[model samples]
Target: MIITRCLRPSFLAKPRLPPLSGCRQFWGWLNAVFNRVDYERIKDVGPDRAASEWLLRCGAKVRYEGFDKWQYDYNGLPTGPLGKYKIQAIDATESCIMSRGFDHLDGLEHLEELKLCQCIYIEDTCLERISKTDNLQKSLRRLEIISCGNVTDKGVISLHSLRNLEFLLLRDLPGIQKKEMILELLQKSIPPLQIELDLKD
Candidate 1:
């Protein structure tokens, strides 16, 4: 799997390319001779605006950690007709959003691991969308939500649908007051699935 890294704009410009003419010539010549590099390194080439476009063009596994917002173009995420997807992990911790963060991600049929840390606005509704994904019961294995204050029993209940899930981690969420209740629900939902529960006030 090709790993594409997106760097900040300030950092991209610092690389000090020789000039557009040199870059164009080098790329033109390289393309003619080689099979094309699987990994394309991009820095601040355009707003995150072009990020989705590039993902489609390359068809490579992505690790995008920073974006201006929590919501992204739905078309960019892997979905049906696109065949198996290959995003190993996504860390959208501090990004901005009003509600659930997984609605647009329903198409990622091959997503194995997901992380939402410090996304304060994420709630049960977001988790509901994630649970509804196709083959999610069999595809997803690990899920982690930390410091998401709005998450509660409703969200925890939604997670019960992940039948094939192996690891679940929840921490510092004020809404889940009854730790025992949460544990009971999980035990009943997917009794054989291993879980890691943490509630420290």
Candidate 2:
């Protein structure tokens, strides 16, 4: 926000001040030059805004908190902050995070780690949506689905497309009855995924 004043004595002879006219021109030029850049950091309003804000307030330099569409890729690693302040991880443990709510996930392209611990609302369909995220295929490295009672083998298998995943934690999930399918596909995979499972009865 810059304010500039121009003085034009000759134009002041008329009813309107020529100085004000020049000031308006300068303001217009300023807007034209920087209209595209986001000068003010906006605090977005959304369901996940609280979560994102919590992270930021706790010294997490996160710019966006999600529940939108997969606009960016799951970037960075387990804990290190990335180049951009985009969402790098999601912790929906015991939260209201659900399967149908994944429409918002499409916007979280920079998400890397996702924790759905005790999220009873999520199901295999959520994994289906996760698999579709372009960034998940390239950037997502860690996925944790613990005690999500609705997820099954089919849903767990849906994550097979996340090729870059390095760690997968599935514990206390009674929904995933057949663990072999998941283990066979990911445990000894090309990237050698590190996994933790407790599907046994």
Candidate 3:
């Protein structure tokens, strides 16, 4: 895969903080300018205070790690205009990543990859969003849910919509009960998709 990391511009002046009520609009404008560039990978380690909000603003794919104490409501993250680039991967293994709602990922048409390692609260509804969004499932290619206790058969079934998927890795999921569905989805969704299935019941 082609990976590119472009540093945020240093000369551009940061916008003034808007009120909480206008968060959506603020996020929309933020995406308009920063979301156009495509990047294969991005890591946010520093505590910019606005890191979470900024992430929502830019449709850039990112890898977030090392901030175990940082906390943000995922619903607050921006989803941009329909079909805009949304985050493709998130490594929250070492951090406290919480979703305010499953709809936080709604409208993320270009998301292709996702990693939610060690995120404790993600549930089936979040996965349902994956299946419900035609763009996400059709475009998604890789997915990794490791050591996440809440993901289950229903969540696995959500992947059925991923027709272009190629790689899937599920590890340490003790609650997933639909192994047959998982295998069937992989087989039917994308006959050629490379997959790795691991379950501990």
Candidate 4:
């Protein structure tokens, strides 16, 4: 009697994926959680505090009104009165903030400066959302978008909605062509808005 051993078919074997594949998925989920907007939380704590929690959780830094130091550490955030710490500036360098989470910017009445650097997920829609935010359009003055590859002239031009914007800085945005034309258009739309660009000619 000859006994034959059944061999597993190669097609049934699992393909090797990158070792960090699971890590990538974990990070993606974590970022989503961090970016989640709790409208109730916003109402209960006010937009500044709620937005502070979101930004800090997503690895961004925020400076509150009348504060010279940036608040970055998630655990070390101020325990002072919630409404007292109105967010005045946001520096989201290398942070995971995406357009879906920008509802936090909706009611920021005092936000004057914003910096988005190396924010891999930022795109035209993100800028569009910012442009359309009523409070931001009225109060935001200084803006910086650096090393965010997805931003293009369309996104940059959407800043026209920010009627009060005073300054804009663009650097290393490979997606922006006709840099000169974009500059001209932005200056024309917002006459008081000064712009600085480091995009390659």
Candidate 5:
């Protein structure tokens, strides 16, 4: 009697991966796709709509102008009139938004409040970009940045451009050095702005 064993070919065998590796890869790919900026789509749907789509796709929530309920689901996005529904507030906690996608916020004249929490991709350049935006500088009122480790004093100080900003809240930002000095500068630059911080020296 001859014993024969069947062995799977190396090429056909599945590669071993660490726990949640596949899931991580999938999420990374999805985030990359969500962050992609399509200029044609922006021109077609308008900046608010395009920005809303991007925010929703990246696990962020948006509150439309005059709407109390937040729009979080990508599939359930409001569809009535393109320019009618303007973005009023954005909650981009743990979202995949990067500096490249900042262009989507250019023409959002009604945007009032923006919260960025645990957004690992946010950096000084991103803050500088939004701070310099003419529309955001005029319209934005409240801004909250929490646990965004990449934000530093340079980025925080650049927010002085938001001349109309009424409130600023910052928490758990390890990158921000000279928090007291930054706060003083902010106070001097924007006299009416109120800032709240939970930072360590």
Candidate 6:
């Protein structure tokens, strides 16, 4: 891990380049997509823009529109044997991927992990969209919804759509005051989901 981190920056240090061709493409895509924000390095500039930039740097195909929104464009990319999709974190903030922003993640055929740790606008709709993903039912293994203010029992209930899910982490939401639905479904289900929650005032 340390070695990979050390070599990532050498991506822009030299002009001729080395065997790390992916770095070249990484920068190329960042420049092409943002077309603004002179990206010297992946730094969090706030408004979740930095997270978006970092996700792009990490090799995820992305699209941005309006003030603070983004989506993965996995269309032109390969889809057969070695399709590139194993998203472990969606560490975005400010306005990135709010409300129905998860609509962007719907068909990501290989996404294995999800993180919406903190966002003001994250709500049931986003969770609903994530639950409806065609690929999530088959591939998702872990999920995190931490400190998101707008999510509720409705959103948590929507998770029933993720039949293949194995682990879940829910924390610090204003809604979801009761545990009947959350407890009843998950506890009785087969291949029981590993659940962790913190809903304290």
Every candidate's CA RMSD: 17.5, 18.8, 18.6, 4.3, 3.4, 16.6
Using all chains and alpha carbons, the TM-scores for the candidates as numbered come to 0.57, 0.58, 0.54, 0.88, 0.88, 0.56
Give lDDT tens digits, candidate 2, residues 24-114. Answer: 8785454333222221222243323333433322223233434343322223212323323367676665554544445444445666777
lDDT at position 35, candidate 5: 87
lDDT of 2: 0.62
How do the residues 1-201 of candidate 5 rate in per-residue lDDT, one tens digit apiece? 999999999999999776798888887777777888899999999999999999998889999988899999999988887798999999999999988889899989999999999998899999999999999999999999999999998999899899999999999999998887998989999999999999866
Off by over 4 Å in 6: 1-89, 93-95
Q: Residue 196 in model 5: shift from native, Å?
A: 0.2
Collision pairs in model 4:
none
Q: Which stretches of candidate 2 lie over 4 Å from their true place?
A: 1-84, 188-190
Q: Give me the overall lDDT of model 5.
A: 0.92
For candidate 4, lDDT tens digit of each residue in 1-201?
999999889999888876798888888888888889999999999899899989999999999889899999989888877688889999999999988799999889999999999999899999999999999989999999999999988999899888899999999999999787888888888999889999965
Candidate 6 achieves a global lDDT of 0.59
- The superposed Cα distance between candidate 4 and the true structure at residue 142, in angstroms, equals 0.4
As a whole number from 0 to 100, the lDDT of residue 63 in candidate 5 is 97
Residue-level lDDT for 108 in candidate 4: 95
Tell me the tens digit of each residue's lDDT in model 6 across 46-161: 32343344444433433332213335432342232322223434544432344423433543555566777665556898788778777777877888788888888888888888
Which residue pairs of candidate 5 clash?
Answer: none
Q: If both were scored by TM-score, which would come out higher, candidate 3 or candidate 6? A: 6
lDDT of 4: 0.92
Q: lDDT of model 6 at residue 82?
A: 28
Residue pairs whose backbone atoms clash in candidate 1: 100-126
Please report the TM-score between candidate 2 and the true structure: 0.58
